[model samples]
Target: MDVRKLAACVLVAATAGCTVVPGSNMNRMNSVWFDDTPEEYTPAETDIQYIPINATVLAHLNQQAQKQPLSNAELEAAISSYHYKIGLGDILTITVWEHPELTIPSGSFRGAEESGNEVKADGSVFYPYAGTLYVLGLTTSEVKDLVTERLSSVIKRPQVDVRVASFKSQRVYVSGAVKQPGIAPVTNVPLTLVDAIDQRGGLDEDAAWGDVRLTRNGHTRNISLRSLYEQGAWSENILLQHGDQIHVPRNDADKIFVLGEVNRPQGLPMSRTGTTLAEALASANGINESKADGRGIYVLRNTGISRDENNNPIYTATIYHLNAASAVGFMLADKFALTPRDIVYVSPAPITRWNRFLSQLLPSIVATDRIGDIQNNN
Candidate 1:
């Protein structure tokens, strides 16, 4: 190997050693500091916790995993109990048994079976025998009872049936990162978050399945589809109501960025399957065996300022380290869940890097500097 060229590379790198600008967001989010440093080394205002990766930590983290609000049974019950109300512009088909003459008029443009009576702006629908009956704020079953009562005055033992012919009143708007973005009408059948999305032919390729935003009556909530599929959390499939807006956002959580002495540096896409440190490293072909300090594997998690109960701004910056030299280190890495936009870094061996610098890198840099000096003198 060209020893002079190798030394020059190290000299240039050493001259510009790792720097952390104090009070910078980037510094707090991306730390290259060693784990062996004294505890007294005051971190920025952010309460940065440096945790050593171990079995206990993994178990605790797994237990603290956030669970979905609704279970499968609860979701099913909600669906079964859901009832849709009549709204203005809703078309209803009113049927009267054993009274065909009253129900369907001969020479009528639209047949009784195919025709529907629309709920007018006054919240009333005009029927042949029932006259103008109020249906807005009532269910299909309630409308049936009202029609039956009104028909009894005209005919003896009247049986009436009411069904929604065309649902056009209550609807939910679906937009952004979907195959089709538009208003989906709510019918007598139950309408759910999943059903609404499916009606539009499912989400587009760029849709952020993990961060779906739902706005209902000006109140917005975020739902993670990742938790639904992975944890089977049924609550994520919530029932969509009237005037509800659901937007499938594009995946912009960034990436699980891995850098430093790893064999392959990359910004890996975080998966719903819960990407762990070991999986990320494997994708990057693991840390450099020759130069990597197994004791210095660190994962930096950047948390923006969050307000506490007292409304005080709390900066909770967390960094996790794995001592890969230990037998259990790889096991711990396998269980450590990586959050989106996390930064994983495997540092070079401190002693080896310094030795290389002193033996070759430093010499080449000095020689190059002296050569420059000689040229200037000439």
Candidate 2:
């Protein structure tokens, strides 16, 4: 149990290719920061790559980001039409010219909605001359034509105009990261994606643009609302249907984790626009200058893994090393984009590792030396 003997044994075990204490593995991670072996850079040969952050890689990544995700198409296709039609429980007002007795007029106190004919659960609305007629799937214009034809038999050249007095049948629900999260009615004039969002008071300040979710019929799809406005990708503004749900998700998922030797290591959420590597480091109060390795700042992405067919976990992280020691390195960091779930790791300097090791090991060595001196005195 002597401290010197334990240290000697650990040194021996590590050299003998045996498993030592967990702390001994610190050097293994140290290998990732500074090791410049050429074979690892080869895509076909190695599992992990060591890509230096530079102009070329930044441009490529930025271009790839501009290409919207393929899932947007499926979301757009789900909403085939934006046309509005009559549905059960909807109030319809039919106005007749020069027919005061026949048409139930709204009084000074009563509104047109109060005198309107409501589509019953059976999808039928009853009128004076039209009798009981099914109006489901019929638009306001079509309903007017049908009512005028029925009234023509009673009154010659019956002038009739039909409109939706109240919309109470179909609805599009909006929630999450919006100024007003509530239901937006599907009106006689077709409601598109933008209309529903505007009706709910637009997106909230904390909302992420690309994270707009549209859920319908138990299927959920994502569309980038930012593209609609900024990039002029008008295709994103697809039609919304009855029973459709729109949610502008919060930017929680777009946060990046700053770990290791940063002054204030924490998860930083991205803005509605975006967050670059420079911004992320700035938010973390930059790296610890005294202890951090200037050449070892890394951005590790896709650190997540999927299991192979054999049930073995597979890691395919694309790591980008940034040597802040270089003059242009900080400029490159400004250009590098930080995506959601990325890890910005600033590895410790060699002196830092030595200092930490001595901090842990010196106390035991000192106590043992004191005990030895006490025994000699005894």
Candidate 2 TM-score, C-alpha based: 0.79
| Steric clash count of candidate 2 | 0
Q: Pick the candidate with the highest lDDT.
A: 1
**Cα lDDT of model 2 by residue, 351-372, tens digit:** 6766665576567667777776
lDDT of 1 by residue, 212-285 (tens): 99999899999877777677777778888899999988766647999877889999887646689999999999
Q: What is the C-alpha RMSD of each candidate to the true structure, in Å?
A: 7.0, 6.7
In candidate 1 the C-alpha lDDT for residue 123 amounts to: 97
Inter-residue clash pairs, candidate 1? 7-361
